[model samples]
Target: MGASHKKPSQDDSNLEIYSLICLDPSFHNNEETVKAQQQLRVSINYLKIFENCYQCEEYIRSVSSYNRFILIINDELARQIVPRIEQLRQVYSIYIHCLDKITNQQWAKQYLKIKCLSDQLDMLVTRIQSDHRINDLFPVVIYNTNELNFHFLYSHLLFDCLLRMNSNNKNKFISLCKNEYKNNENELNIIHEFEENYSANQSLSWYTRKSFIYRILNKALLTQNIDLLFTLRFFIQDIYQQIEQKKCLYPIRVYHSHLMTYEEIQLIENSLGQFISINSFLSACLDRGLALFHLYEPNDLQRVLFEIDADLQLNDMNHFGYIKLVNYCEETEQIFFMLGSIFRIENICLNDDEIWIIQMKLCTENDCQLKSIFNILRNEYHYGQDSNLLSFGEFLIKQGYLNEAEKYYLRLID
Candidate 1:
């Protein structure tokens, strides 16, 4: 708990950062506690450790109002700090871990934000992991980008610009990874292996390995963490390139199963005739029956299956693939659609088994009326035919991403 604080980078000032903060008397000294904190850091980007309760309180109060914070405190400090931080608007969820659950539960049960007051370290980790997933995996729908239509012009242009830029700085990216995983031995070794052995050819292999790269990349994309995204652009470009190279040559149908809240369910149901743009890489399977294995009924969330249709014959960036490296098991036939994939909602209905089945077609400019919309986006965003990297900073600047533009130019100067 010495100096593990992360000051938000200026480029990510607009982004909503998620942090896991642990306030323990001596968590770092214990081997098991170190491992648990390592696990939390593996998935979460920012983690702060503090042995002093007073200092943590000051830090929490200093954090921005827009960011999300999850806290873990021992029963000893829970009583001291719970009443103070419980009412703060930035506290998302709190977990009280202690040896005496019976005594702690008596008081923690009344707190609205205390998710769990458990004696089991494993149970405490499970609840935190589940809650973290709910926050990180919340899909970024294109609906909020515009009320007039769902052409997803903003996302399309964003990805278009990032992928086309040069990503040759491997040392810088690897150094960043090393700092983030310094506490975890396993991740540190993987980072070393990557530094010595990585190549452009093994892009997909590395991404599919569930390594630190995969965890941080997806989290950065979900949060629109511009600084982290810039640090990760080298691998991002390589992975997407390999996916593009391995694009299937014929029509393919892939499936993805996900949990959605009632509000998200209604948003898709009512958006049947319109288009919805998904912000991240979609991990889908070629076999519908195989995809069903990921679904389960939960009282709090609805199970939904995505039947995605892609016609690779159309010739566009809307490519999906079955990369051997990304395919964990040959039987799964796992396929993935690239980032910023746009799809028109063809249909949505509940099956007899109570699973919400959705039908969507991967769209290219030629297959639909998106040609006009695409041109409108280019004109509206100042992305003309002559646009190049010279305009990227200007683009970010015009879009109110001044700090991101600053970082982009600084990197260019580097």
Candidate 2:
């Protein structure tokens, strides 16, 4: 590794790819535009304000495909420009914020991508923030056991590497988080508190703070966005270390309820008696009633109640733990599992309430199949070690994320 603790160069700063595009001509020099960004919880620098459809369209076209734009435009300009950019994937969502909503609704109905048409900016901003966060809450990756997928194996090995790694990147994490939430006063205040009060022991508490940090970090895991994930690795390690220190001394059971896609439900059903891994941190409660209480009536999604029987007494099975100290909710008994904890699907069925209950048993080094493949990856790719952060770079290269891997190594190089 290049310079052991040298500050990351400026070349690595702008990893946040969200572009908030404001296309209202009235917003060119208006103080109200700043208020809208604050309400939307978007930073000022990330919000690109434009005065005309021409300039807005040019900027939309200029933004790299890696960045997504949440467009807030007046209906008149939206009508003029929506047709040109409606099909583009970079335009994540579009909202028409004009007085004549009744008139705009007629034409806006034709476009499938327009998210909302509102005369009220506050309501529109709330809607925008809700949609943005709701989008981030879901979208986790799962391994399918019926196929020869290697993601679960990679997850085990890579997170193992993250366990023993250390970095002087807490300042980098704080800076990046502040940049992401700059003009959003509530989260900015939280970031300040986090920077001032943060410690390794407080990682779980911060992770549970129902704010930008946890959501953005989870989103990074979902998309494998290495830049953000790597920046936040120090926090990840802290949580893991905390879990290890407080691990359950014996066998225990926990439950978690979430909305899962029908496909994911079926994947679990089809893979019963085999193994699967979720690619993010897992939190579950000891109270089954608490788990059932949170389940929603299914619409487009399936209600999944995960019943985990974790036997930490097994060799090398201290991957999850009971933590009431900083367990977000004081009322419930919470067990926090580190990222990518593998589980054998014991059974899957619908209960009398019609909710899918997936019964899973924690797998450990004692599991022959898991241990064998884990060793193969560790020895074959030189990434089985938990001794250093450099193995993560090697794992990235093995996964074919060349650009992400290169950037990771550049930060590691002395």
Candidate 3:
């Protein structure tokens, strides 16, 4: 080796450090507190000092980003900070160093690492730096508080974790959910009963209740928990009522991606029909057309297609929706609507090859007029190749059009 060089410590070089010092107003004369404050400022890149607990809270709300927090506070200040433990837990890795003994040691244990004045500040800094896997850590509410409802938080965390999991892991998670629900059926029933009773007596408006349920609905949508979504359809109706009252089209837009039953799709369409203008309603309906196509019976599918065609004609809008419908019909071998849709959209929204193939196939199968097929081939496609002419002649012969077949062969020979 030419020369020897020393690498910097990962803890010192890599980690972003933040410290919060809540100074006791009564401890201005205290030597140890002053020394700890000095040590914190020297060690951390960002250090915030507050004279009292109130200022500390104000700073907590104002300060936007931080990786770790070192709180140096007195007993009374720590008590004031307890209410904010849930919020602080969400964003920061917290370590508390109280100058005096904390009265509520149990609460402190649940939320923070209580340290003595004599303990080295380096240890706290070192601990934060060593844990490089903070981003990988899932959101978990470690402490139980009666005031703060964590049910939604727990569900949100589970949904996020489930989303990141592979298919096998997701199946395992679903199995786990089923097993847990079976085991806790009685508890679940009791909780449901309590919620119903509570809702009946509560001063909360229906809108407020709807807002709460909407959060759960979003979680269900993200997880693709169709059973959970079905159970929540009652709440969705409540949201729909609010949307109707306000004549707002935004909420109806959320249903676009949802995999719903035919009845549910019809219900949404009917509800939207009342408030929206004809053109807007028709345009919005297109969003759920595919979902309806998947779920509807043959009779219902025909009804839906008729309604769509009527709306497209009434509004004088182009039949772009029919493009997907035509492709789906082709895949399913339901050619009844294919020719109609292709003919309706004069300049069909398909590639040249696709259009040619569909046109040729439909003409051969349906015994279409020879002049119309010849017009498309000569005027539209200008297909002059011998192979294409021969193929068309063979297709005409197969369709019992001997004169048309002879004409194609004569044109190719010329």
Best by TM-score: 1
Clashing pairs in 2: 1-414, 2-413, 2-414, 3-414
Candidate 1 residue-wise lDDT, 331-378, digit = tens: 234677888777888999989998999998888755445666666666
Worst 10 residues of 2 by lDDT: 1-10
Q: Best to worst by lDDT, what's the order?
A: 1, 2, 3
The model with the greater TM-score, 2 or 3, is 2
**Lowest lDDT 10-residue stretch of candidate 3:** 356-365
lDDT scores for all predictions?
0.70, 0.69, 0.32
Off by over 4 Å in 3: 1-17, 26-30, 89-103, 112-414
Model 2, 262: alpha-carbon shift in Å? 4.9
For candidate 2, give the lDDT of residue 108.
Answer: 87
Residues 8-88 of candidate 2 have per-residue lDDT tens digits of 122322344455788876874667666777666543236768888998888777654435678899877888999999877
Top candidate when judged by lDDT against the true structure:
1
Global Cα RMSD, each model: 5.8, 6.3, 27.3
Residue 95 displacement (Å), model 2: 4.5
Order of the predicted models by TM-score, top scorer first: 1, 2, 3
TM-score of each: 0.77, 0.74, 0.24
